[model samples]
Target: MRIVIALGGNAMTAPDGGARVEDQLAAIGAAAEPIADLVLAGHEVLLTHGNGPQVGNLLRKNELAATVVPPIPLDWCDASTQATIGVTILDALDDALGARGSDRRTTVLVSRTLVDRDDPGFAHPTKPIGRYLTRDEAEPLIDHGQEFVEIAGRGWRRVVASPEPRECLDAAAADTLLAAGYVVVCSGGGGIPTQRTADGRLEGVEAVIDKDLTAALVAGHIGADLLVIATDVATVIRGYQTPTQQPIGTLTAPAMRELAAREAFAAGSMGPKVEAITRFAERGGIGVITSLDRITDAVTGTAGTRVVPAG
Candidate 1:
Protein backbone atom coordinates (compact mmCIF):
# COMPACT_ATOMS: atom_id res chain seq x y z
CA MET A 1 0.00 0.00 0.00
CA ARG A 2 1.12 3.55 -0.66
CA ILE A 3 0.63 5.15 2.71
CA VAL A 4 1.51 8.53 4.15
CA ILE A 5 2.06 8.71 7.92
CA ALA A 6 2.07 11.92 9.96
CA LEU A 7 4.30 11.45 12.97
CA GLY A 8 3.46 13.43 16.09
CA GLY A 9 6.06 15.75 17.62
CA ASN A 10 5.67 14.26 21.07
CA ALA A 11 6.71 10.94 19.62
CA MET A 12 9.87 12.53 18.27
CA THR A 13 10.91 13.72 21.73
CA ALA A 14 11.45 11.52 24.74
CA PRO A 15 9.31 12.38 27.75
CA ASP A 16 12.39 13.37 29.74
CA GLY A 17 14.36 14.25 26.66
CA GLY A 18 15.48 17.81 26.96
CA ALA A 19 16.67 19.63 23.82
CA ARG A 20 19.81 17.56 23.52
CA VAL A 21 21.14 16.04 20.31
CA GLU A 22 21.68 12.64 21.91
CA ASP A 23 18.13 12.53 23.18
CA GLN A 24 16.65 13.54 19.82
CA LEU A 25 18.61 10.91 17.90
CA ALA A 26 17.61 8.19 20.35
CA ALA A 27 14.01 9.33 20.33
CA ILE A 28 13.91 9.40 16.53
CA GLY A 29 15.44 5.93 16.31
CA ALA A 30 12.80 4.53 18.64
CA ALA A 31 10.03 6.22 16.71
CA ALA A 32 11.35 4.87 13.42
CA GLU A 33 11.00 1.22 14.44
CA PRO A 34 7.36 0.78 13.40
CA ILE A 35 7.85 3.01 10.38
CA ALA A 36 10.77 0.90 9.22
CA ASP A 37 8.52 -2.13 9.55
CA LEU A 38 6.13 -0.68 7.03
CA VAL A 39 8.96 -0.18 4.59
CA LEU A 40 10.23 -3.72 5.07
CA ALA A 41 6.74 -5.03 4.41
CA GLY A 42 6.99 -3.57 0.90
CA HIS A 43 4.62 -0.69 1.55
CA GLU A 44 5.35 2.59 -0.20
CA VAL A 45 5.50 5.26 2.48
CA LEU A 46 5.56 9.03 2.61
CA LEU A 47 6.32 10.64 5.95
CA THR A 48 5.42 14.01 7.48
CA HIS A 49 5.96 15.17 11.05
CA GLY A 50 5.56 17.95 13.60
CA ASN A 51 8.47 20.17 14.66
CA GLY A 52 6.79 22.33 17.31
CA PRO A 53 9.33 21.72 20.03
CA GLN A 54 12.18 21.73 17.55
CA VAL A 55 11.04 25.01 16.05
CA GLY A 56 10.54 26.43 19.50
CA ASN A 57 14.13 25.59 20.31
CA LEU A 58 15.29 27.11 17.05
CA LEU A 59 13.49 30.35 17.87
CA ARG A 60 15.17 30.41 21.25
CA LYS A 61 18.52 29.88 19.58
CA ASN A 62 17.89 32.78 17.24
CA GLU A 63 16.90 34.93 20.17
CA LEU A 64 20.07 34.05 22.03
CA ALA A 65 22.18 34.65 18.93
CA ALA A 66 20.66 38.10 18.51
CA THR A 67 23.12 39.56 21.04
CA VAL A 68 26.07 38.53 18.84
CA VAL A 69 24.54 38.24 15.36
CA PRO A 70 21.40 39.62 13.81
CA PRO A 71 18.28 37.58 14.54
CA ILE A 72 16.79 35.97 11.48
CA PRO A 73 13.06 36.08 10.82
CA LEU A 74 10.82 33.44 12.26
CA ASP A 75 9.93 32.00 8.85
CA TRP A 76 13.58 31.31 8.03
CA CYS A 77 14.04 29.82 11.44
CA ASP A 78 11.10 27.46 10.84
CA ALA A 79 12.52 26.33 7.50
CA SER A 80 15.92 25.65 9.05
CA THR A 81 14.38 23.78 11.96
CA GLN A 82 12.27 21.52 9.74
CA ALA A 83 15.27 20.70 7.60
CA THR A 84 17.21 19.71 10.71
CA ILE A 85 14.34 17.50 11.88
CA GLY A 86 13.95 15.89 8.46
CA VAL A 87 17.62 15.00 8.25
CA THR A 88 17.67 13.60 11.76
CA ILE A 89 14.64 11.40 11.18
CA LEU A 90 15.91 10.19 7.84
CA ASP A 91 19.33 9.32 9.21
CA ALA A 92 17.87 7.54 12.21
CA LEU A 93 15.50 5.52 10.06
CA ASP A 94 18.26 4.58 7.69
CA ASP A 95 20.49 3.47 10.52
CA ALA A 96 17.73 1.48 12.21
CA LEU A 97 16.86 -0.33 8.99
CA GLY A 98 20.52 -1.25 8.54
CA ALA A 99 20.77 -2.50 12.11
CA ARG A 100 17.80 -4.74 11.44
CA GLY A 101 19.49 -6.22 8.33
CA SER A 102 17.24 -4.34 5.96
CA ASP A 103 18.63 -2.42 2.98
CA ARG A 104 15.82 0.03 2.39
CA ARG A 105 16.89 3.53 1.40
CA THR A 106 15.43 6.63 3.06
CA THR A 107 15.41 10.16 1.72
CA VAL A 108 14.52 13.41 3.45
CA LEU A 109 13.16 16.15 1.23
CA VAL A 110 13.33 19.71 2.46
CA SER A 111 9.78 20.55 1.49
CA ARG A 112 7.97 23.81 0.84
CA THR A 113 4.22 24.39 0.60
CA LEU A 114 2.30 27.07 -1.24
CA VAL A 115 -0.24 29.12 0.68
CA ASP A 116 -2.71 31.75 -0.43
CA ARG A 117 -1.39 35.27 -0.17
CA ASP A 118 -4.86 36.44 0.83
CA ASP A 119 -5.40 33.71 3.42
CA PRO A 120 -7.46 35.13 6.25
CA GLY A 121 -5.28 33.42 8.81
CA PHE A 122 -2.66 36.16 8.36
CA ALA A 123 -5.15 38.72 9.61
CA HIS A 124 -5.73 36.59 12.70
CA PRO A 125 -2.58 34.80 13.84
CA THR A 126 -3.70 31.97 16.11
CA LYS A 127 -0.80 29.50 16.06
CA PRO A 128 1.14 29.97 19.32
CA ILE A 129 4.91 29.83 18.95
CA GLY A 130 8.19 30.67 20.63
CA ARG A 131 8.79 30.57 24.39
CA TYR A 132 5.90 30.92 26.76
CA LEU A 133 6.11 34.21 28.62
CA THR A 134 4.30 35.58 31.63
CA ARG A 135 2.44 38.88 31.18
CA ASP A 136 5.12 40.99 32.78
CA GLU A 137 7.88 39.06 31.11
CA ALA A 138 6.32 39.63 27.71
CA GLU A 139 5.66 43.31 28.30
CA PRO A 140 9.06 44.34 26.96
CA LEU A 141 8.66 42.29 23.76
CA ILE A 142 5.11 43.44 23.28
CA ASP A 143 6.20 47.03 23.67
CA HIS A 144 8.67 46.43 20.85
CA GLY A 145 5.83 45.10 18.60
CA GLN A 146 6.33 41.39 19.22
CA GLU A 147 3.03 39.66 18.50
CA PHE A 148 1.61 37.84 21.48
CA VAL A 149 -1.65 36.54 22.86
CA GLU A 150 -2.78 35.95 26.43
CA ILE A 151 -4.15 32.50 27.10
CA ALA A 152 -6.12 33.59 30.12
CA GLY A 153 -4.94 31.24 32.89
CA ARG A 154 -2.07 29.76 30.82
CA GLY A 155 0.14 32.81 30.40
CA TRP A 156 1.06 34.51 27.11
CA ARG A 157 2.70 33.20 23.92
CA ARG A 158 3.68 34.48 20.50
CA VAL A 159 1.01 33.46 17.98
CA VAL A 160 1.57 33.24 14.24
CA ALA A 161 -1.10 33.12 11.59
CA SER A 162 -1.74 29.53 10.52
CA PRO A 163 -2.75 29.75 6.91
CA GLU A 164 -4.33 27.08 4.73
CA PRO A 165 -1.97 25.17 2.44
CA ARG A 166 -2.61 25.37 -1.28
CA GLU A 167 -0.06 22.94 -2.66
CA CYS A 168 3.00 20.96 -1.74
CA LEU A 169 5.80 22.53 -3.79
CA ASP A 170 8.04 19.49 -3.49
CA ALA A 171 5.39 17.10 -4.78
CA ALA A 172 7.31 16.22 -7.90
CA ALA A 173 10.53 15.47 -6.07
CA ALA A 174 8.75 13.30 -3.50
CA ASP A 175 6.84 11.52 -6.23
CA THR A 176 10.09 10.77 -7.95
CA LEU A 177 11.42 9.15 -4.83
CA LEU A 178 8.25 7.10 -4.46
CA ALA A 179 8.62 5.90 -8.01
CA ALA A 180 12.22 4.93 -7.29
CA GLY A 181 11.27 2.78 -4.27
CA TYR A 182 12.59 5.14 -1.60
CA VAL A 183 10.89 5.87 1.71
CA VAL A 184 10.45 9.61 1.46
CA VAL A 185 10.18 11.83 4.52
CA CYS A 186 8.93 15.23 3.49
CA SER A 187 6.67 18.07 4.57
CA GLY A 188 7.83 18.45 8.12
CA GLY A 189 5.94 21.16 10.02
CA GLY A 190 3.60 21.72 7.11
CA GLY A 191 6.38 22.37 4.58
CA ILE A 192 7.50 25.73 5.94
CA PRO A 193 4.44 27.68 4.84
CA THR A 194 5.19 30.06 1.93
CA GLN A 195 3.23 32.36 -0.36
CA ARG A 196 3.78 34.07 -3.70
CA THR A 197 4.37 37.76 -3.39
CA ALA A 198 2.72 40.29 -5.71
CA ASP A 199 5.93 40.38 -7.76
CA GLY A 200 5.58 36.59 -8.28
CA ARG A 201 8.37 35.69 -5.91
CA LEU A 202 7.70 33.02 -3.31
CA GLU A 203 8.31 34.24 0.22
CA GLY A 204 8.18 32.35 3.47
CA VAL A 205 5.30 33.32 5.72
CA GLU A 206 5.44 33.47 9.51
CA ALA A 207 2.78 30.82 9.96
CA VAL A 208 2.33 27.10 10.20
CA ILE A 209 -0.05 25.13 8.06
CA ASP A 210 -1.65 22.35 10.05
CA LYS A 211 0.63 19.32 9.62
CA ASP A 212 -2.21 16.81 9.39
CA LEU A 213 -3.94 18.90 6.75
CA THR A 214 -0.69 19.05 4.79
CA ALA A 215 -0.46 15.27 5.12
CA ALA A 216 -3.89 15.02 3.57
CA LEU A 217 -2.77 17.20 0.69
CA VAL A 218 0.23 14.96 0.08
CA ALA A 219 -1.90 11.81 0.30
CA GLY A 220 -4.42 13.18 -2.14
CA HIS A 221 -1.68 14.36 -4.47
CA ILE A 222 -0.05 10.95 -4.54
CA GLY A 223 -3.32 9.05 -4.73
CA ALA A 224 -2.40 7.25 -1.54
CA ASP A 225 -4.26 4.12 -0.55
CA LEU A 226 -4.23 5.12 3.12
CA LEU A 227 -3.36 8.16 5.23
CA VAL A 228 -2.47 7.45 8.86
CA ILE A 229 -2.12 10.21 11.43
CA ALA A 230 -0.25 9.07 14.55
CA THR A 231 -1.43 11.43 17.23
CA ASP A 232 -1.57 10.90 21.03
CA VAL A 233 -5.01 9.27 21.08
CA ALA A 234 -6.20 5.70 20.71
CA THR A 235 -9.43 6.85 19.15
CA VAL A 236 -11.30 10.03 18.42
CA ILE A 237 -14.07 10.65 20.92
CA ARG A 238 -17.17 12.77 20.81
CA GLY A 239 -17.23 15.25 23.72
CA TYR A 240 -13.69 14.18 24.42
CA GLN A 241 -12.54 13.84 28.04
CA THR A 242 -16.09 14.32 29.27
CA PRO A 243 -18.35 11.79 30.97
CA THR A 244 -20.49 11.63 27.84
CA GLN A 245 -17.52 11.07 25.56
CA GLN A 246 -18.08 8.56 22.79
CA PRO A 247 -15.15 6.59 21.36
CA ILE A 248 -15.65 6.29 17.64
CA GLY A 249 -13.48 3.80 15.77
CA THR A 250 -15.29 3.64 12.46
CA LEU A 251 -17.11 6.68 11.11
CA THR A 252 -18.30 8.11 7.82
CA ALA A 253 -17.42 11.63 6.77
CA PRO A 254 -20.93 12.94 7.27
CA ALA A 255 -21.10 11.59 10.79
CA MET A 256 -17.72 13.08 11.63
CA ARG A 257 -18.88 16.39 10.19
CA GLU A 258 -21.99 16.45 12.37
CA LEU A 259 -19.92 15.63 15.43
CA ALA A 260 -17.41 18.31 14.54
CA ALA A 261 -20.21 20.88 14.30
CA ARG A 262 -21.13 20.05 17.89
CA GLU A 263 -17.59 21.00 18.95
CA ALA A 264 -16.77 17.43 19.89
CA PHE A 265 -13.05 18.12 19.42
CA ALA A 266 -10.88 20.77 20.99
CA ALA A 267 -9.66 23.43 18.59
CA GLY A 268 -5.98 23.25 19.47
CA SER A 269 -5.85 19.46 19.51
CA MET A 270 -8.18 16.95 17.91
CA GLY A 271 -9.78 19.52 15.66
CA PRO A 272 -7.00 19.39 13.02
CA LYS A 273 -6.90 15.60 13.07
CA VAL A 274 -10.65 15.35 12.43
CA GLU A 275 -10.53 18.06 9.83
CA ALA A 276 -7.65 16.29 8.06
CA ILE A 277 -9.52 12.99 8.15
CA THR A 278 -12.64 14.61 6.72
CA ARG A 279 -10.65 16.22 3.94
CA PHE A 280 -8.81 12.99 3.12
CA ALA A 281 -12.06 11.02 2.94
CA GLU A 282 -13.58 13.79 0.86
CA ARG A 283 -10.68 13.56 -1.55
CA GLY A 284 -11.17 9.79 -1.99
CA GLY A 285 -8.41 8.77 0.39
CA ILE A 286 -8.99 6.54 3.39
CA GLY A 287 -7.85 7.76 6.82
CA VAL A 288 -7.11 6.53 10.32
CA ILE A 289 -6.13 8.59 13.41
CA THR A 290 -4.77 6.93 16.51
CA SER A 291 -1.79 6.56 18.83
CA LEU A 292 1.62 5.74 17.37
CA ASP A 293 1.89 2.19 18.71
CA ARG A 294 -1.42 1.24 17.08
CA ILE A 295 -0.22 2.27 13.62
CA THR A 296 0.54 -1.24 12.36
CA ASP A 297 -2.85 -2.51 13.45
CA ALA A 298 -4.52 0.59 12.10
CA VAL A 299 -2.92 0.04 8.69
CA THR A 300 -3.91 -3.65 8.77
CA GLY A 301 -7.52 -2.57 9.40
CA THR A 302 -7.64 -3.58 13.03
CA ALA A 303 -7.59 -0.31 15.02
CA GLY A 304 -7.84 3.49 15.08
CA THR A 305 -10.64 5.77 13.94
CA ARG A 306 -11.17 4.51 10.39
CA VAL A 307 -12.76 7.16 8.23
CA VAL A 308 -14.41 6.56 4.86
CA PRO A 309 -16.32 8.65 2.39
CA ALA A 310 -19.85 9.66 3.28
CA GLY A 311 -22.70 7.76 1.70
Candidate 2:
Protein backbone atom coordinates (compact mmCIF):
# COMPACT_ATOMS: atom_id res chain seq x y z
CA MET A 1 0.00 0.00 0.00
CA ARG A 2 1.10 3.55 -0.64
CA ILE A 3 1.10 4.86 2.89
CA VAL A 4 1.74 8.19 4.60
CA ILE A 5 2.51 7.76 8.29
CA ALA A 6 2.20 10.77 10.58
CA LEU A 7 4.38 10.28 13.63
CA GLY A 8 3.06 12.03 16.71
CA GLY A 9 4.92 14.91 18.32
CA ASN A 10 5.52 13.39 21.72
CA ALA A 11 6.87 10.24 20.06
CA MET A 12 9.80 12.22 18.63
CA THR A 13 11.10 12.71 22.16
CA ALA A 14 9.91 11.56 25.51
CA PRO A 15 8.47 14.22 27.80
CA ASP A 16 11.41 13.74 30.13
CA GLY A 17 13.97 13.43 27.36
CA GLY A 18 16.40 16.28 27.93
CA ALA A 19 17.22 18.78 25.20
CA ARG A 20 20.16 16.76 24.03
CA VAL A 21 20.83 15.76 20.40
CA GLU A 22 21.96 12.28 21.36
CA ASP A 23 18.77 11.55 23.27
CA GLN A 24 16.60 12.81 20.41
CA LEU A 25 18.56 10.60 18.02
CA ALA A 26 17.96 7.57 20.22
CA ALA A 27 14.22 8.22 20.19
CA ILE A 28 14.13 8.55 16.42
CA GLY A 29 16.12 5.35 16.14
CA ALA A 30 13.48 3.50 18.10
CA ALA A 31 10.76 4.99 15.88
CA ALA A 32 12.66 4.06 12.76
CA GLU A 33 12.72 0.35 13.61
CA PRO A 34 9.05 -0.31 12.93
CA ILE A 35 8.98 2.12 9.99
CA ALA A 36 11.88 0.29 8.43
CA ASP A 37 10.09 -3.00 8.83
CA LEU A 38 7.18 -1.56 6.87
CA VAL A 39 9.50 -0.41 4.15
CA LEU A 40 11.17 -3.80 3.94
CA ALA A 41 7.74 -5.37 3.72
CA GLY A 42 7.44 -3.75 0.28
CA HIS A 43 5.13 -0.87 1.04
CA GLU A 44 5.99 2.49 -0.43
CA VAL A 45 6.23 4.78 2.59
CA LEU A 46 6.23 8.55 3.04
CA LEU A 47 7.12 9.67 6.53
CA THR A 48 6.04 12.83 8.35
CA HIS A 49 6.71 13.46 12.05
CA GLY A 50 5.90 15.98 14.77
CA ASN A 51 8.46 18.23 16.41
CA GLY A 52 6.37 20.05 19.02
CA PRO A 53 8.65 19.31 21.94
CA GLN A 54 11.73 19.89 19.83
CA VAL A 55 10.53 23.23 18.53
CA GLY A 56 9.36 24.32 21.96
CA ASN A 57 12.73 23.41 23.40
CA LEU A 58 14.37 25.54 20.75
CA LEU A 59 11.98 28.39 21.55
CA ARG A 60 12.92 28.14 25.21
CA LYS A 61 16.57 28.27 24.20
CA ASN A 62 15.92 31.35 22.10
CA GLU A 63 14.15 32.95 25.01
CA LEU A 64 16.95 32.12 27.40
CA ALA A 65 19.54 33.60 25.03
CA ALA A 66 17.56 36.70 24.14
CA THR A 67 20.06 38.91 25.95
CA VAL A 68 23.06 37.38 24.15
CA VAL A 69 21.53 36.85 20.72
CA PRO A 70 18.46 38.00 18.86
CA PRO A 71 15.46 35.69 19.11
CA ILE A 72 14.31 34.35 15.78
CA PRO A 73 10.70 34.19 14.62
CA LEU A 74 8.51 31.17 15.34
CA ASP A 75 8.61 29.86 11.76
CA TRP A 76 12.41 29.80 11.80
CA CYS A 77 12.32 27.58 14.84
CA ASP A 78 9.96 25.25 12.98
CA ALA A 79 12.41 25.08 10.08
CA SER A 80 15.31 24.26 12.40
CA THR A 81 13.36 21.48 14.04
CA GLN A 82 12.37 20.09 10.64
CA ALA A 83 15.98 19.91 9.49
CA THR A 84 17.15 18.41 12.77
CA ILE A 85 14.39 15.83 12.96
CA GLY A 86 14.78 15.02 9.27
CA VAL A 87 18.48 14.27 9.68
CA THR A 88 17.78 12.14 12.73
CA ILE A 89 15.09 10.15 10.90
CA LEU A 90 17.44 9.67 7.98
CA ASP A 91 20.26 8.41 10.21
CA ALA A 92 18.01 6.08 12.14
CA LEU A 93 16.55 4.68 8.94
CA ASP A 94 20.09 4.09 7.75
CA ASP A 95 20.73 1.88 10.76
CA ALA A 96 17.38 0.08 10.55
CA LEU A 97 17.32 -0.56 6.80
CA GLY A 98 21.04 -1.35 6.73
CA ALA A 99 20.55 -4.16 9.23
CA ARG A 100 18.21 -5.86 6.77
CA GLY A 101 20.60 -5.26 3.87
CA SER A 102 18.00 -3.24 2.04
CA ASP A 103 19.41 -0.80 -0.49
CA ARG A 104 16.46 1.58 -0.41
CA ARG A 105 17.39 5.25 -0.37
CA THR A 106 16.07 7.54 2.35
CA THR A 107 15.96 11.32 2.17
CA VAL A 108 14.54 14.32 4.03
CA LEU A 109 13.00 17.29 2.28
CA VAL A 110 12.37 20.58 4.09
CA SER A 111 8.67 21.22 3.56
CA ARG A 112 6.57 24.38 3.52
CA THR A 113 2.80 24.50 3.42
CA LEU A 114 0.47 27.23 2.22
CA VAL A 115 -2.15 28.67 4.54
CA ASP A 116 -4.48 31.59 4.46
CA ARG A 117 -3.09 34.76 5.94
CA ASP A 118 -6.51 35.59 7.24
CA ASP A 119 -7.10 32.25 8.93
CA PRO A 120 -9.15 32.85 12.08
CA GLY A 121 -6.77 30.57 13.94
CA PHE A 122 -4.25 33.41 13.95
CA ALA A 123 -6.62 35.52 15.96
CA HIS A 124 -7.34 32.71 18.38
CA PRO A 125 -4.35 30.48 18.60
CA THR A 126 -5.42 27.31 20.40
CA LYS A 127 -2.82 24.66 19.61
CA PRO A 128 -0.90 23.63 22.74
CA ILE A 129 2.85 23.49 22.32
CA GLY A 130 6.02 22.68 24.24
CA ARG A 131 6.02 21.19 27.69
CA TYR A 132 2.96 21.76 29.72
CA LEU A 133 3.55 24.95 31.61
CA THR A 134 2.19 25.93 34.98
CA ARG A 135 0.20 29.14 35.29
CA ASP A 136 3.24 30.67 36.89
CA GLU A 137 5.40 29.69 33.95
CA ALA A 138 2.88 30.78 31.31
CA GLU A 139 1.96 34.16 32.72
CA PRO A 140 5.10 35.86 31.43
CA LEU A 141 4.51 34.61 27.91
CA ILE A 142 0.84 35.46 28.01
CA ASP A 143 1.69 38.92 29.22
CA HIS A 144 4.04 39.34 26.30
CA GLY A 145 1.27 38.68 23.74
CA GLN A 146 1.61 34.94 23.37
CA GLU A 147 -1.59 32.97 23.83
CA PHE A 148 -1.95 29.83 25.92
CA VAL A 149 -4.74 27.50 26.92
CA GLU A 150 -5.10 25.45 30.07
CA ILE A 151 -5.36 21.79 29.17
CA ALA A 152 -8.01 19.81 30.99
CA GLY A 153 -6.57 18.41 34.23
CA ARG A 154 -3.16 18.80 32.68
CA GLY A 155 -1.43 22.15 32.73
CA TRP A 156 -1.09 25.43 30.87
CA ARG A 157 0.59 25.27 27.49
CA ARG A 158 1.52 27.85 24.90
CA VAL A 159 -0.93 27.79 22.02
CA VAL A 160 -0.37 29.12 18.54
CA ALA A 161 -2.63 29.63 15.58
CA SER A 162 -2.91 26.25 13.91
CA PRO A 163 -3.89 27.37 10.44
CA GLU A 164 -5.36 24.96 7.92
CA PRO A 165 -2.88 23.64 5.39
CA ARG A 166 -3.94 24.39 1.85
CA GLU A 167 -1.06 22.92 -0.12
CA CYS A 168 2.37 21.38 0.32
CA LEU A 169 5.31 22.97 -1.50
CA ASP A 170 7.78 20.13 -1.05
CA ALA A 171 5.37 17.35 -1.98
CA ALA A 172 6.62 17.03 -5.52
CA ALA A 173 10.13 16.43 -4.26
CA ALA A 174 8.89 13.82 -1.82
CA ASP A 175 6.80 12.18 -4.51
CA THR A 176 9.74 12.01 -6.91
CA LEU A 177 11.86 10.44 -4.22
CA LEU A 178 9.16 7.95 -3.32
CA ALA A 179 8.85 7.06 -6.96
CA ALA A 180 12.59 6.40 -7.01
CA GLY A 181 12.35 4.00 -4.02
CA TYR A 182 13.39 6.42 -1.27
CA VAL A 183 11.63 6.31 2.06
CA VAL A 184 11.26 10.09 2.05
CA VAL A 185 10.88 11.81 5.44
CA CYS A 186 9.45 15.23 4.91
CA SER A 187 6.94 17.75 6.32
CA GLY A 188 8.05 17.99 9.91
CA GLY A 189 6.02 20.06 12.41
CA GLY A 190 3.15 20.73 10.06
CA GLY A 191 5.61 22.05 7.51
CA ILE A 192 6.86 25.51 8.32
CA PRO A 193 3.66 27.53 7.80
CA THR A 194 3.82 29.88 4.83
CA GLN A 195 1.71 32.21 2.73
CA ARG A 196 1.81 33.43 -0.84
CA THR A 197 2.26 37.02 -1.84
CA ALA A 198 0.41 38.78 -4.64
CA ASP A 199 3.24 38.04 -7.02
CA GLY A 200 3.02 34.38 -6.01
CA ARG A 201 6.21 34.53 -3.95
CA LEU A 202 6.08 32.61 -0.69
CA GLU A 203 6.84 34.06 2.73
CA GLY A 204 6.97 32.38 6.11
CA VAL A 205 4.07 32.97 8.46
CA GLU A 206 4.16 33.01 12.23
CA ALA A 207 1.97 29.99 12.73
CA VAL A 208 1.99 26.23 13.06
CA ILE A 209 -0.06 23.74 11.05
CA ASP A 210 -1.24 20.59 12.72
CA LYS A 211 0.99 17.72 11.60
CA ASP A 212 -1.98 15.39 11.22
CA LEU A 213 -3.66 17.87 8.89
CA THR A 214 -0.56 18.16 6.78
CA ALA A 215 -0.27 14.40 6.80
CA ALA A 216 -3.68 14.34 5.21
CA LEU A 217 -2.54 16.79 2.59
CA VAL A 218 0.53 14.68 1.85
CA ALA A 219 -1.50 11.50 1.72
CA GLY A 220 -3.86 13.07 -0.78
CA HIS A 221 -1.04 14.56 -2.80
CA ILE A 222 0.66 11.21 -3.10
CA GLY A 223 -2.67 9.49 -3.66
CA ALA A 224 -1.93 7.23 -0.70
CA ASP A 225 -4.14 4.26 -0.04
CA LEU A 226 -3.94 4.75 3.72
CA LEU A 227 -3.13 7.45 6.24
CA VAL A 228 -1.68 6.04 9.45
CA ILE A 229 -1.34 8.39 12.38
CA ALA A 230 0.91 6.81 15.01
CA THR A 231 0.22 8.57 18.24
CA ASP A 232 0.97 7.61 21.85
CA VAL A 233 -2.42 6.04 22.42
CA ALA A 234 -3.32 2.55 21.25
CA THR A 235 -6.68 3.72 19.95
CA VAL A 236 -8.82 6.81 19.83
CA ILE A 237 -11.35 6.78 22.63
CA ARG A 238 -14.46 8.72 23.44
CA GLY A 239 -14.97 10.59 26.75
CA TYR A 240 -11.20 10.70 27.07
CA GLN A 241 -9.93 10.92 30.63
CA THR A 242 -13.43 10.46 31.95
CA PRO A 243 -15.25 7.63 33.64
CA THR A 244 -17.03 6.86 30.39
CA GLN A 245 -13.88 6.63 28.31
CA GLN A 246 -14.17 3.88 25.71
CA PRO A 247 -12.22 2.85 22.66
CA ILE A 248 -13.74 3.28 19.20
CA GLY A 249 -12.93 0.13 17.27
CA THR A 250 -14.33 0.94 13.84
CA LEU A 251 -15.70 4.17 12.45
CA THR A 252 -16.90 5.74 9.26
CA ALA A 253 -16.43 9.39 8.31
CA PRO A 254 -20.04 10.31 8.95
CA ALA A 255 -20.08 8.59 12.33
CA MET A 256 -16.87 10.30 13.43
CA ARG A 257 -18.19 13.65 12.26
CA GLU A 258 -21.24 13.21 14.44
CA LEU A 259 -19.07 12.28 17.42
CA ALA A 260 -16.75 15.17 16.73
CA ALA A 261 -19.71 17.53 16.59
CA ARG A 262 -20.79 16.31 20.00
CA GLU A 263 -17.23 16.94 21.21
CA ALA A 264 -16.43 13.30 21.79
CA PHE A 265 -12.70 14.02 21.59
CA ALA A 266 -10.53 16.59 23.27
CA ALA A 267 -10.02 19.56 20.99
CA GLY A 268 -6.39 19.94 21.98
CA SER A 269 -5.54 16.27 21.62
CA MET A 270 -7.52 13.80 19.55
CA GLY A 271 -9.56 16.40 17.71
CA PRO A 272 -6.92 17.14 15.10
CA LYS A 273 -6.26 13.45 14.52
CA VAL A 274 -9.93 12.74 13.96
CA GLU A 275 -10.40 15.87 11.90
CA ALA A 276 -7.49 15.00 9.61
CA ILE A 277 -8.50 11.39 9.26
CA THR A 278 -12.06 12.40 8.52
CA ARG A 279 -10.87 14.49 5.62
CA PHE A 280 -8.97 11.53 4.19
CA ALA A 281 -11.82 9.13 4.85
CA GLU A 282 -14.11 11.50 2.99
CA ARG A 283 -11.77 11.14 0.07
CA GLY A 284 -12.53 7.42 0.10
CA GLY A 285 -9.24 6.47 1.70
CA ILE A 286 -8.63 4.57 4.93
CA GLY A 287 -7.43 6.34 8.06
CA VAL A 288 -6.10 4.51 11.11
CA ILE A 289 -5.17 5.95 14.45
CA THR A 290 -2.89 3.91 16.69
CA SER A 291 0.12 4.07 18.93
CA LEU A 292 3.59 4.15 17.48
CA ASP A 293 4.16 0.53 18.42
CA ARG A 294 1.02 -0.69 16.65
CA ILE A 295 1.47 1.19 13.38
CA THR A 296 2.19 -1.90 11.27
CA ASP A 297 -0.92 -3.69 12.47
CA ALA A 298 -2.99 -0.56 12.15
CA VAL A 299 -1.96 -0.26 8.52
CA THR A 300 -3.19 -3.79 7.96
CA GLY A 301 -6.52 -3.10 9.77
CA THR A 302 -5.65 -5.48 12.59
CA ALA A 303 -5.41 -2.82 15.32
CA GLY A 304 -6.25 0.78 16.18
CA THR A 305 -9.39 2.78 15.46
CA ARG A 306 -9.91 2.56 11.74
CA VAL A 307 -11.99 5.19 9.93
CA VAL A 308 -13.45 4.61 6.51
CA PRO A 309 -15.92 6.15 4.11
CA ALA A 310 -19.60 6.51 4.90
CA GLY A 311 -20.64 3.00 3.83
Count clashing residue pairs per candidate. Answer: 0, 0
Q: Against the unseen true structure, what C-alpha lDDT does each candidate score?
A: 0.84, 0.86
What is the lDDT for 161 in model 2?
Answer: 82
Q: Lowest-scoring 10 consecutive residues by lDDT in candidate 2?
A: 62-71
The residue ranges of model 2 lying beyond 4 angstroms of the native Cα positions read: 15-19, 124-159, 242-244
TM-score, every prediction:
0.92, 0.89
**Global lDDT of model 1:** 0.84
Candidate 1 per-residue lDDT over residues 146-244, each given as its tens digit: 588988888888887888888999888998899898999898888878899999999887787889899999898888989999987888877766799
Which candidate leads the pack in TM-score?
1
Query: What TM value does model 1 have?
Result: 0.92
Candidate 2 residue lDDT tens string, 1-311: 89999988656775574547767877788899999999999999999988877887887875456556665678998899899889889989999999999878899888899999888998887766666767876666666566778888998877778888999988988889999999988888889999998888899987888899999998999889999999888988888778998998888999989988986566667988999999999998999999989988997789998889997
